[model samples]
Target: MRFFRRLMLCVAPALLGVAASEPLSESFDVSVPQLPQIVATDGGKAVRYELHLTNFATVPLAVRGILVTDADTGKILRSFSRRPLLTHLIPLSGTRDDPSSARVTIQPGARAVLYVELSGPLPRRIGHTVDYVAACETCPLRLEIPAVAVNQAAAVTLAPPLAAGPWAAVQSPDWPRGHRRVVYTLDGKARIPGRYAIDWVGLDDAGRTTRGDPDRAVDAIGYDAPVLAGADARVAAVRDGMVESASIARNPDHVLGDGSGNYVALDLGQGRYAFYEHLRPGSIQVKVGQRVRRGQAIGALGFSGDTTGPHLHLHVANGLDPLKAEGIPFVIDSYTEIGRYDDIGALGSKPWQSAGPTRKSHEWPASNVVVRFR
Candidate 1:
């Protein structure tokens, strides 16, 4: 907390006019590895980031809640607590299964991470107010940590990989398993390559993901759909001849470290690369060093890698390796939002409730929304 308190000397307190007698605040440490980046969403703007916390106190402490506020104005923007907070908090050290308590409770010398996603408009600077239940009587209940500046950098805008389809923009806010939470370590460095990733699962006219036999790859609506180049760039990496998953029930873990089966990485320049993963066997048309135009067919969507069904796993990253790189935000040039699915289990069978074909430009579709790229 000494480090945190020293950094926030110029920032406003969480409770204005109320001095925070942070007696025990100096016993703990908190930080953010990768700062929050503002991205345009279908509904509005959103900031997605994480908070890493370490406990130095001799006793255990339970995090009560977390509040996000405008740093300059001291206006409360969003708050999380109880079940909602527990769902996003993850214990990075010690045992995960403690029947008496949750993983959010930071044990002495243990570390944890808090996943946060704030929707709507926000200021350039933000502050965090964290409340904790400590064992010591001198420990203050609240600590205000500010100086977290929001990255207003514009997201890389690209063309849709699939030329035409009512694609279900599938994603979940669940941590420890969601694309946003999965991290990979390569060369002794960890990175989240799927931080802003999306699985483009195509839907048929009837709003079904597949027809005939669901287990067969040939029946999947997205199977063999032409995958296009998101931008005009040189091919940095290419992999092919990956055996497609015979059944939707198959797991690619047996293949080991081949999650991005038969993929292609395009160099988007400026330290950016676009990865198109889970492509059909022998469908990759470009080779390494080949420059492709936007909207050019690069491959076909197929059930490969760590997949349950046929879909295109597309994401932008800062490196060439699919797993080693850190994921970054990318916006579609133009797409029409048609409908949406609230539940993942009901994706194919349940028809999507239609909405006005909202023509969204230079923005990424929100999770579970249906968008048509034409």
Candidate 2:
């Protein structure tokens, strides 16, 4: 009987159909922030996840396929073959090739980033699990994402920071943070942060962004625009004295200290911080520790930081430091979706079409959609 028990123990795993050998690096790492990082936006019409994939081998790993499915029901949520999956890796930090490039190769010790967004109407809570199959030559991986890890609750709702006027949600969270990278901070410390940051630009008639020539700082319409407090809050921190660059080229060295150049951070209670960045030097009106009210003028928008031009770089995060904190989502009480902008064409020449005059409330504008505040 003792011999029979030992044999059963040995055959138990096989009876349960366990694999005899693991993949080359089946233990390869997949990093995600604490669970329930899932966020809902566009009035809960969308759900997003920022996933990081790391390859810890010496040879290059090519991500050739992907599959996202409902774990319980075996329903396929999303799937990508080699061709489409390659596009997903195009925006990763290291890859420089066009989307037409067939395969995205991850260099040894590098990460392959992916931004996953599932359109709603979705459940308030996922209540199940998601199965992920990332097919690769050297790092093929399969894992499950818990439903509890994704929170579909409403993001923060707040009053519009700027007074009534035309402004462009030039770079907004309506989509992934950058054209591809989902998290707000360039540094990986932030998890699902800055998911909804907005780089706002005010526009004028004649489809011109500035008053004069495009290259001149003074010609930009966003220059000197009044940046207001989005809510009643206390000043948390301030950074000033960084000179605005003469042109739109970003100086990589300044990203750490002056990237947000001459900015104001407001504590909006409940541990939420409102960041108003890229302000003109000496234009800040409130000092740290000062109490401020909604609609109070804080500073003029400027080109002082790591920016393409003069625009309000606004976002909310969990902590005081923008670089370290995870980005949180918020909604403007109301704004009118006025038009769309052509980013590749001459600056500000994008045509404005009537999304109609009707004003929409409790809305979050997507990236590149022009809107008016009233």
Candidate 3:
């Protein structure tokens, strides 16, 4: 009920006008049980408690810090605060802030969940509360969740499956010469936020990649896109309401937190997930719980979400939660590495290396050369 009350407060006109006029700050709502209860697991051990934070502000707000303390002693029990992603894509005009600093901006009326995990030996009594303090530009806001004790098994669930494919091998014969060639160039730099791989893929009639200009082949080439299930075991989630937006680089959605305009997340077995972000919104064709064939046409490509242009943001990770998940390396079946930066090594072949001389030239590989996967 506290979360509900906070949600109402966020949309109130007075708060809305202030948030719209000034730089926003951090706030939170707690949904845990009202009465503090003791949680028992493994017959007598303390259960792990997960905390989720919901943002209801108009501008983005960063979660600068989180502190969990013993109510009786006022002693801090745990704390967590840091930017999770290695590479971040800032708007060309936006100010550059500290990387470890909480720079999260929850779009107006939108919601993003921040998670915290707490595990411990059993506490003997109830009536304790966990206090959380978070901040942005101005001052910090405090929230408290009443602790509860319960004897229940934690539920484990699998994430969606990786997009399947009649994967196409597109050619990038004229890829720019450099260690960062595969990376999208923003402000003349290659390291962008989120882990991704780039390669050329021939598009079929049903594929959106074909719509790109071919003569501007370097810009025209499309990735070997895959269609993934939104949830594990079958299709479990689908949203078909949003329409795709035209490609626009670095345009932040003033209306929403970099709207992942529309997307499908498949729950792969075992808490793993595959996220197909920025799919043409409203193009979703699959239904909840419907089993889909591999490489099925779930939707077309679009420029949505926290993106500047129309490039797919692809990754495989341990969970559906972006902030808490670890990005893992993955590969498509096959493609040719038509060219290489003599000074930099192979394309789509290595973790981003920042220490070496940047490559400046490349020659197309032989027509029949097989592209190796990393």
Inter-residue clash pairs, candidate 1: 1-28
Kindly list the per-residue Cα lDDT of model 2 for residues 1-374, writing each as its tens digit: 00000111122343556754343332224555533333434444655555556656566555555565554555656665555566454334555434564556666677766555566444443322212223344333443434424555466666776765577776632333362255444564545445667888878744568777777666688788888888889999988777876766443347455667889999988888999998988899999999999888999888887777788888887889866676766777778776666452544775555465556677667657677776
Tens digit per residue, CA lDDT, model 3, 89-196 = 121223344665554444435433322223464333222232223333344444445443443422222122223221222222123331111222334422211222
Highest-scoring model, lDDT:
1
Candidate 2 clashes: the total is 9
Of the candidates numbered 2 and 3, which has the greater TM-score value? 2
Ten-residue stretch with the least lDDT total in model 3: 359-368
- Best-first order by lDDT: 1, 2, 3
TM-score of each: 0.89, 0.79, 0.35
Clashes of 1: 1
Runs with alpha carbons beyond 4 Å of true place in candidate 3 = 1-233, 247-250, 254-258, 340-374
- In candidate 1, position 368 carries an lDDT of 88
What TM-score, to 2 decimals, does candidate 2 have?
Answer: 0.79
Clash count for each candidate, listed in order shown: 1, 9, 35
